[model samples]
Target: MGTATGSSFDTETLRRGVEGTTGNTLLSLYADDAQIRIIDRNTQPSHPKVLRGRGEIAAMLDDVYSRDMTHKLDRCVVQGDHAAYCESCEYGDGTRVLAESMITLRDGKIAEQILIQAWDE
Candidate 1:
């Protein structure tokens, strides 16, 4: 496992990972102990879905990337030990999903993240 010199998050890696077809690239950006909080229509903010550790996160990523869909990183900003990004995805049936994430970084890897998303229903 390699880390950056300080608290700098790597946006280039993020761009490469987000646009990739598989989850492997994006998974590499997370620390082993990372956690993610997801909020959507099915999961409200009052009781959001939380994924702990790389195992759960990886599973979720794989499932998402394996689907017949397209994902794009619309925007991203990184500062010191934090970052935020917007992601847009479209399914084969033309269902569109938009997600925005606020993230915390540790050792240049994603330590924790809270993502809110909405989908065409």
Candidate 2:
């Protein structure tokens, strides 16, 4: 991982990064050493699945963004290096989510992110 210098986490930056990627902007933002892990409770054996490496995560998001449309975020709360947010997003076909996310920062860059998503009817 290459060292990242002069990165800062503010409401605007986080919002832009998330909205850009989730709102059909096709833009990606990641820490040089960022890793995303997910566990779906609905699936069998709920173990963490690591989306290893920054580049892979970015590419995965690219595939996601290509098929997704608008994302709307609301009810955001942030303090220090942690944030919790809620989102209403629409994706391909008719897929949509009312999701909540917890975000953590390390050295002013996104270090960890976890999301809990529920399908909206």
Candidate topping lDDT: 1
Deviation in Å, model 1, residue 83 alpha carbon:
0.3
lDDT of each: 0.90, 0.62
| C-alpha TM-score for every candidate | 0.93, 0.71
lDDT (10s digit) by residue, model 1, range 1-121: 2234385677877878888899998999999999999999999999999999999999999999999999999988777678899999999999999999998888899999999999999
lDDT of 2: 0.62
Question: In candidate 2, residue 61 scores what lDDT?
Answer: 71
For residues 1-121, write the lDDT of model 2, one tens digit per residue. 2122344455565566557755223223456677766545553236665666577677767775666576666767766776677877787677776867776767666667776666755
